[model samples]
Target: MIRMIVKDLRINPLRTGLTALSMFIGIVALIAGVLVGTLGRDYLEAVNARLSGRTPTYSAIIDVTSVAGMQTTMTLQERLAHFEPGSASAQYHLNDLAIWASSGDGGLEIRHVAVTVTDAERTRVMPAPIIEGAWLTAADKPATLETVVNENARQYVHDGTITLARTGNPQQVPARVNGVIVDGADEPVIYVNAAALQRYWPQAWTPDGLTILVHPDAGVDDRHAKTALDDLLADVGAGSVSSWNRSDNADEYEQVIDFLQLGVIVTAMLLLAVSAIGMINIGLAGIEQRSHELLIRRALGATRASIAAQVIGSSVLLSLIIALAAVLISASLVWMVPWMMPADSPLEPPAYPYTAAMIAAGASVATSLIGSLAPAIKAIRLQPALALR
Candidate 1:
C-alpha cells in the first residue's frame, strides 16, 4: 500500500505539490508565531533579571520645608550632618536637578530626575541592573556648575544628550552628554550630583529628601522603619519623611509587556486557524481528484480496509514532508537573522520548542485524516461494478 502511494505521488506530482505546499505554509505560520512569542518573553525576562538587581536599594522620595522662625541655615551639608541615614539608604542624593524639555509640544517642561547615590550605592539598590554609565561623581560637581544626566532618560528628550536651564531664563547650563543608564523601567531619566543639582531651577526644593541605606538588622519591620523614620525626622527637627519602592516604573512596563503577550497569543491562534483551513481545503481537493483512480483500484479487488489505509498513510507522509520543508526554511532564517541585528541589542536564547512542534505535527496529521474521511466513505459506498464502468 505504501509502495502504491509512493508510485501515485511520482505519477501525480502536481497534486502532491499542492497538498505539501498548503501544509508547509501552515507549519511555517505556526513556527513563526511561536518563535515570536518566545522572543517577546525573552526580552521581558532579561529586562526583569536586570531590574531585580536594583530592588534592594529601596529608592524613595522626600520633600521637606522649613517652619517659620527656625533661625538656622538649611544648607544640604548641614542637613546631611543633621540626620544620619540608615545603612540601607544612600547617604546623599541629587535633590532638585531635573531635565528640562518640552512636555511634547507644551512650551516648556521638566522631568524630575535625580542622580542616584554613589556608583556603588545605586548598583546595590536600583530596581533593575544598570546597563551603561557611572553615577555622577563628586568631580561631576560644579567647577562650572554643570550636570550629568542618566542614560535611559535621554530617550525621551534627545537621542543621546539634552540641555537644562531655568524654565524661563535665557541661561543655559551645559551638561556634557554622558553615557545612558537603564533599569527595568526604561524611562527618560537623568542623574547629577546633589550639590551640582542646586544650580538648576526647579518648582520645588528641599534639604530633607532622604535616600537612606537601611540596615540589615532583622528586627526592622515596615512598622518599625516607619516609626523610626518619623522619630528621626522629629529629632532632627525638619524634613517630611517617606519611603517608596524604586522599581515601580519597571513593574508598570512589565505589566504592559505581559498584556501585549496575551494579545499576541490570541491573535496567533486565530491566524493559525485561518491557515489550517487553507491546508484542509487543499487536502480535500487532492482526495476528490483521485476518486476515479480509487474506483479503478476497487475494480482490481482492493479491500475497503486497504483503501482506507492507503488514504490515511498517504496523508501522513505528505504532512511529514511539509513539516520538514517548513522546518528547513525557518531554521535557515534564524541562523542568518542574528547577524543582521544591532550589536548592542541584548543576546537572547531563541526558543525552538520540541513539544510545540510535535503538537503542530499531530494537528497536521489529524487534519489530514479528517480530510480523507468523506472521500474514503464515498469510495466505499460505490459497488465495484458501478465503479469499474
Candidate 2:
C-alpha cells in the first residue's frame, strides 16, 4: 500500500509539488508568527527591566512633614540600610530625595542639575546600564560626595572633580563624577548616595519618595511582602502611603503582545485552511482522472479500506515532509537572528520557540487528513465494472 501510494504521488510530480508548496507556506507563516511574538515580548521585557526595574517592584511616596511620618521614614530608612539578602521582607528598599544642585567649571558658568539622593541599594533596586565608569558602592568615601550622572548630564560633567553646591548657595563642595548611566531622563540628573548627602549636606538628606523591590528569588510572594510593608508602616504611624506595582504596567504590555499573537496565528490558520481547501479540490479532480486505475486495483483483490488508506497516507506523508522542511528553515532563521542584529542593539534575540514548531507540524498533519477524507471516500466508491466500460 505504501509503495502504491508513493508510485501514485510520483506519477503526478507537479500536482504533488504544488500542494506541498501551499502547505509549506502556511506552516512557515505559523512559525514566523510565533517567533515574532516571542522576540517582541522578550525585547519589551528587557527594556522594561532597564527602565522600571524587574517584576514585583513597588514604588511609594512618604510624606515627611509630620512627626509620625518622619519617625516612620527613619525606621524604614534603617531597615533599608541593614537589609539582608534573601530576607522575608523586601529585597532592596530605596529612599530618594530630589534636590536642585549646581555643577560645572566654576568660572561664572554654572549648570543647574537635578540630584537624587538615594541609598546605594538604588543600583540594585532599579539598575540602569552604565555607559561609563561604575555605580555607587557601600565602600565609597563619605567625606567627599561621589555622584553618577545620567547621559544628559555627562555633556557638562566629566569623569573628574566638579564643584557641586545647592542652587543659590555659595558654599560649594567638590564632587567626583565616578560614573555615567542611562536613566532615560531628558534633563540632567545626578545620583548621589544618601549617606554621603547626610554627611556633607545634612539639609538635603530628607527623602520624599521611596522604592521597594522584591527579588523574584527571595522566596516571598508579592502579597505577603506588601502586607508586611503595610504592617510596618502602620506600626510606625507613617502618613498616607501611595504605592504602585510595576507588574501592572508590564501586564498591559503583555496583553497587547498576546492580542497581536492571536491575530497573527488566526491569519496563519486561515491561510492553512485555504491550502487545505485547494488540496481537497485537487484531490477530488485526481480521483476522477484515476478512476480506471482505482478500478484495476479493486479487480486485483485490493480491499476498499486499503485503497482509502493509500489515498490518505499519500497526503499525510506529503504534509509531514513539508512540515519538517518548514520547521528546519524557521529554526535556522531563529539561530541566525542574533548574528544578523547589530552588536549595539539593546534587545537580545531569544532562543527558538519549540512549541511553535510542534504546533505547526501537528496542524499540517491534521489539515492533510481532513483534506484527504473526501477524495479517499471517492476513490473507494469507484466501481470496477463502470470504469472498464
Candidate 3:
C-alpha cells in the first residue's frame, strides 16, 4: 500500500504541489496567530520594565490632569492674593495648569509646567538601570539631596557639585544639585523628597501641586486614595482631587490583546478550513485516479481498513512536509519583526523566531488533517467489486 501511494504521488507532482501550497498557507496563519499574541505581551512587558525601573516620578505614575481654569483674566499678583494660607484645601479645574519644580545646587525653581507621566513602577523603576551613587529605597531617609541631572539639562546648567536655586526673576527657596546622570524618558524631571518639596516653597502646597503616591502594602486603591487625599488636604476640595492608575492602563492593554488574539484564532480557523477543502479535493482526485490500483489490492485480498489507512497515510505524509516548511517560514518572519523599532527605524533584517517556528509546525499537521478528510471518506466509499472488474 505504501509503495503504491508513493508511486501514485510520483505520477502527479502537480497535484502534490497544489496540496502542499494549501496546507502551507494554513500552517502560516496558525504560526502568525501565536507569534503576534506572544510578542504583543512581551513588548508591553519590556516597556513596563523600562519605565518602572528604579524610580518613577509622578508623571509615569499618573496621567493627564490640570487645574480647572486658566483664563481667569488676572495677573500673577492677582493669583497670589487668592492664596488662602490658612485655608486647608482648594480645588481647580483639572485641565488648567502645568505642575513642575526644579532643584539646583543654588535653590529650587518651580516651572509649574504642564506635563504628563509617561510610565512608572510599583516600587522599582523598571529596566534596572544604573544610578549615580545611591539607589532610591522606600526608607524614610531624607530624599537624596545629591541630585542626578538630565543629559539635556546638563548642557546649559553647570555640572560637578553645583548649588541649586530658582532661575526665574521671582524669589524661591534654594536646593543643592549633588550629582547628575542620564534620565531617559524619566528626564526633563527634577527629583526631590516629598517633604523637601513642601518645605522648599513654603507657599506652593496650596490646594495645588498635589503628588499622587502608592498606598503602602495595600497597593493602588482609588477610593482609599481619594479618601486619604481629602483627609490630608480637605480644603483642597473634591474638585482638586484627581486620580491615575497604572493598573487601569494595563487592563485596557490586556483587553485589546485579548481581542486581537481572538481575531487570530478565528483567522487561523478560516485558513485551516480552506486547507481542508484543498486536501479533500486532492485526496479524492488521487483516489479516483487510483481506482484500478485499489481494485488490484482488493482482488489480492487487502482488507478495506488497510486501503483506507493507505489513503489517509498519504495525506499525513504530505501534511508533515507542509507543516515543516510553513513553520520554518513563519518562525523566520517573527524573528525578523522587531517589537519596537524607532519611528524611523535603522536596523538589520531579523531572523526566525524559534518558538514561533515550533507553533507553526502544529498548524502544518492541522492543515494536512483537514485536506485528508475527503480522500479518507472516498477511500471508504470504494466498491471492491466495481474496482475488481
Tell me, by lDDT, which candidate is best: 2
Q: Which candidate, 1 or 2, has the higher lDDT?
A: 2
Candidates ranked by lDDT, best first?
2, 1, 3
| Candidate 3 stretches greater than 4 Å from native | 1-8, 42-248, 292-301, 332-367, 383-389
Candidate order by decreasing TM-score? 2, 1, 3
Worst 10 residues of 2 by lDDT: 86-95
Write model 3 residue lDDT over 1-389, tens digit each, in one string. Answer: 77876765677798888887877777777676666666665555445444432111122121213221222211111222232221011111122222224457754444543222111122232332333443222212344333334444443234343233332435433445433333345445433322333334434323233334332222434455445444433333223335544331354356777787788778777877777877787777887887877777777788878877777777777778777777666655566466655422222234455665565666566556666666767776767688645
Q: What is the per-residue lDDT of model 2 for residues 1-389, given as tens digits with 9 covering 90 to 100?
A: 77887887897888898789878988888888777777777666666765666554665444433422333444655565454432222222223333323435444444555766555566555557676787765533343567888877766564375556554555666677778787656788787655555566665444444445543336666666566555655665654346645442577577877887788778877888988898898889888878888899898888999999999999999999899999898889889888887543446666887888899899999999999999999999888777567
lDDT of each: 0.54, 0.68, 0.48
Task: Please give each candidate's TM-score.
Answer: 0.58, 0.72, 0.53
- Scanning candidate 1 in windows of ten residues, the lowest lDDT window is 67-76
- Winning model by TM-score: 2
Q: For candidate 1, write residues 54-95 as lDDT tens digits.
A: 222234344454421122222432333333333333344335
Off by over 4 Å in 1: 41-92, 96-114, 120-246, 249-259, 346-349
